[model samples]
Target chain A: DARVTQTPRHKVTEMGQEVTMRCQPILGHNTVFWYRQTMMQGLELLAYFRNRAPLDDSGMPKDRFSAEMPDATLATLKIQPSEPRDSAVYFCASGSPRTGLMNTEAFFGQGTRLTVV
Target chain B: EDKVVQSPLSLVVHEGDTVTLNCSYEVTNFRSLLWYKQEKKAPTFLFMLTSSGIEKKSGRLSSILDKKELFSILNITATQTGDSAVYLCAVEGGGGSNYKLTFGKGTLLTVNP
Candidate 1:
């Protein structure tokens, strides 16, 4: 079946290390998004891309977090010098191009649970 | 700021019982409200409500939206163990931006046999 796919379903790292997570959006879809879910923050959008280009990333911390879609099928979110507070399940979602006021429904990946010591 | 809130953070019910999940939101340039069922892996799309007061149904699962009150409700009749999962509510905005969804904390449902 068609679905978004994420890599390294689980990850553990020490503080001050770098972490990278990858996502493969559904074939033919153009938009990709990265979100972090936690008990206190619920779900927060870190970044989104439209047609392999970065659209908005205001929710991401410039110092340590970065997201990119180097190609149409692949999107990646990376954290440099990760901190203990960065522990949470990171999800990658994909949507189609905007159609009128509504866009294609977003499909989520299995998500990668990260734990930083 | 856009925000979505889901009530009754959790619910417990037995088989054949009915339950209702509520979600309220405040968002600018409202587009649509969507419901998702998250089990073990990813969240799966359940329903998307746009028009107010129109009940959308699928088998035993149904949902309705209230645009005036900025809220929605999901109703599941005859709860089964398979229905035990976290239900999520999200709101999509119509602004020019690519489209950001404001999601609620989700309501966890537990069904006993």
Candidate 2:
């Protein structure tokens, strides 16, 4: 079955280090989303791309966090100078909404667990 | 701001019992409500409800939405230990960024044998 693949299932980094997480969306999906999950905040949307173009990234911290889709197959989220508060599970999801399709369900990857000390 | 709220932040029940999780939302130009199950990792899609009064079911798990009430309910009958997880509720609203989803805190459910 098709699934979204994420690399480096776990990561441990010191504060101020740069961390990069990668995702490979389902082959034919057109929409990809990046989310951060924390115990207190639950799941927060960081960014999303439709057709390989970023549709929104308002939820991300522009100063330190960046999300990009190098191509249809690869989407990346990078945090420069990571802080202790940045420790969380990062998830990537993809969905394909065809015409007349309502509320297309997003398929999520296993996620990358990042721990910043 | 778009907001989603889930009731009974946590619940514990014996196996074979039934449970109902509640989700309420306040959003502008509402689009749809979605349910997800999260274990130790990423949350997986469970159901998406758009129209009110339409019940969606998959085996022992079923859900329904109420547009007028601005809430939804997820029911699991004959619960199993494997069903222990956090149930997340998300709402999609229309407008400038219609594709974005607002999620609730989620209900943590534990099933004991």
Candidate 3:
């Protein structure tokens, strides 16, 4: 079965360290999204890309967080000088837009559990 | 900005009991509402509702959306221990958001045998 793959299932980093998380979406999917899950805030949308173009990154931390999809197969979220508050489970999801009768369902990656100390 | 809210942040029930989880959203040009079950891994797809009053069913789980009321309900019949998980509610919106999903704080369901 086709699935979204993510590298470094777990990471523990000290404060001020740069952290990078990677995702490989399912073949043929064009839409990619980045989400963060935490106990206090639940799930938050950080950024997303459609067709390799950045659509919106309003949810992301403008200064420290960046999300990019250099190519269709690879999507990355990076944090420059990460902080303790950045600790959370980051998820990358992908979906092919389905208009009309078809439904749009996002397939999620296993998620990278990041703990910034 | 699109928003989603789920009720009963946590619930506890005995096996074989029925439960209903609630979700409400305020999104412009709503495209669909989706349900996902999350355990120790990533959230898994459950149901996607795009229309009002249309019930979507899968095994012991069923869900329906009410666009007019801006809410949806997920019903799990005869719940089992395996049904324990965080049920997430998300809304897909239109306009600037092509298919971006805004998620809510999931409802943690614990079914004890």
lDDT of 1: 0.91
| Cand. 2 Cα-lDDT | 0.92
- Candidate maximizing lDDT: 3
Docking class of 2: medium
Considering only N, C-alpha and C atoms within 3 Å, which residue pairs clash in candidate 3?
none
Q: Write the residue-wise lDDT of candidate 3 on A1-117 in tens digits.
A: 999999889999999999999999999988899999999999899998888899989999899999989899999999998999999999999998666544468999999999999
Q: What is the DockQ of each candidate?
A: 0.64, 0.75, 0.76
Q: What are the chain B TM-scores of all models?
A: 0.97, 0.97, 0.96
Instruction: Give candidate 2's TM-score.
Output: 0.95
lDDT (10s digit) by residue, model 3, range B39-94: 98999999999999999999999999999999999999999999999999999986
TM-score per candidate, chains pooled? 0.95, 0.95, 0.97
Instruction: Give the Cα error of residue A9 in candidate 2, in Å.
Output: 0.7
Best by TM-score: 3
Local accuracy by lDDT, each model: 0.91, 0.92, 0.93
